[model samples]
Target: MTPDEISTYEETLGVLGDIDHRVVERVLREAGWSPCGAGDWAVALRAPDGRAAARISPFDLVAPYTVALYREAAHTRQVPRLFAHRRLVGGGDLQIMEWLEPVDADEAAGFHRALAAREPEVAELADVVRRVHERGRRDQPWFAPKLDDNPDNIMRNADGRLVAADLFGADGPRLYAAVVDDPHLVVTTIPEPERRFMTDIPLTNTGPWPPEVRAAMHESLTTADTTHQA
Candidate 1:
C-alpha cells in the first residue's frame, strides 16, 4: 500500500470510535470477518476479502514497533506489509496487514539452525533478519526478541518468502490477563486521555485470572507505555 493509502486507512479507522472491548470480537464476526486463529499474546481475523487481516491485542502491544519496522523495511521483504494501525476507541490497538501463513515451528527452527551451513535460501533468510535487526536496534527500543528459540515467529507470505512476524511484546498475555481481571486498571495503568476513552468498555473474557498474572500486571504497568502511531 502507498503511504497516502496508509494514512487514509488510519483516518478511516479512527472514525470507528468507541468500540467496547467486550463486544469487539462479536462485532468483527458480525461484520463478516473470519477467525484466523490466535497466538498467545493476541488473536487475529481475516477480512472478508481474505487478502487482508487484523491483529487485535486486549491492550496495545507490538504494533507500534512492528508497524514502524515494516514501514522502514518496506523495500526489504523481511517483514509483513502493514496496511493500517489504530488504537481501539475502548482499549488496545488493531493492526491490518497482509495475511501470511506461519511455517511449522520445527521446520522453521531447523532452517534457522542451518544458517551457518549457508544454504542459499537459509542464507537469504539470515540476510533479511540481519537487515530488520539492524533497523530495529537503530530505531526501536521495543524490538527485542529471542529469535533463535522462537520458531513460531516465522511465517511465509503468499509468495513463499520466510518473513518474520510478531517480533516483540512477550509480556502481552500476562498484561492482558491482568486487565481482564480488573478492568479498572485500564483507567489506572494506560496513560491519561487514552484511558478516558475506554471508561465504559468491558472485557469479554471470563477468567480464573490467577493472582500471579495480576501481580505481573501491577509490576509492569508502572512502566507501561503503548503507542498507536507509527
Candidate 2:
C-alpha cells in the first residue's frame, strides 16, 4: 500500500497499545474509503474505486487470520477473494477484498428460502461452510464458530455468486492475554457463551484461541471500539 494508506492504518492502532484512533478514521475517510458498517471488532469500508471492500481493524490478527483462511483453507470459493493485506505497526491490519454487492431484504429472504429448499447454490454454500469449519477445527485454532447461520452475513459478487462474508471472529481477552503478559490483565467479565464453550472444551473441536499460535493478534478489541467511536 501507499504511504497515505499506511498512514490511515498505523495511526489508529488499537487495544493493548497507545496510538491515536482519531487519526485512523480521519485518514481513512480522507483516503476515500467510505464507511459501510461497524461491528464490535472493526469497521467495514468500500474503496473509492467501487471494486473492492476493506476490513479496517485496530487489532493485529485480522489480516493474518484472513490471509491464513484464504491461503490455508481448502474451500474458499464461497468466500470473498482477498486482494491485499497491510499489517500495521501497533497490532492492526488492513485488508482489501472483493466488493460484494448488497443483498436486499427480498434477496436475502429469497436466499434463505432457497437455502431451506436446498437449492443448488445454497447447497454449495452448505458444503463450503462445512469444509471451512472442519478445516478451522483441524488446522486453525484462532478461528471461532462465527459464521452466522443467517442471510445477513451473505452477499453476492459482481458475477452474482454467493459470497460468505465475516468468516471469522477474534477472542479479545484471550488474544490480548496471549500477546501481553500482563499479570494485572483485568478479567473484565465471564467469557460470552461461545467463548466459554470454547474454553470449556478439551483437546479438539472447540476453537481454542491458543496464545502461542494466535499471539500475533495481540491488539485489544477495546481499543478497536474506541477507534470506531473516534
TM-score of each: 0.61, 0.51
Q: lDDT winner among the candidates? A: 1
lDDT of each: 0.60, 0.54
Q: What is the clash count for each candidate, in the order shown?
A: 0, 1
Query: CA shift at 4, candidate 2, in angstroms?
Result: 19
lDDT of 2 by residue, 80-144 (tens): 77666665434555676777876876777676666546688657655555565656555544446
Model 1 agreement with the true structure over 1-230: per-residue lDDT tens digits: 45785576567566766674445667777889898776544578897877778787655434566666667656757678888876664346678888788798887776567653656755654555556656654553333544434687677888888776665543434435555564445435455444432213123333334567556654444334342221
Model 2 earns a TM-score of 0.51
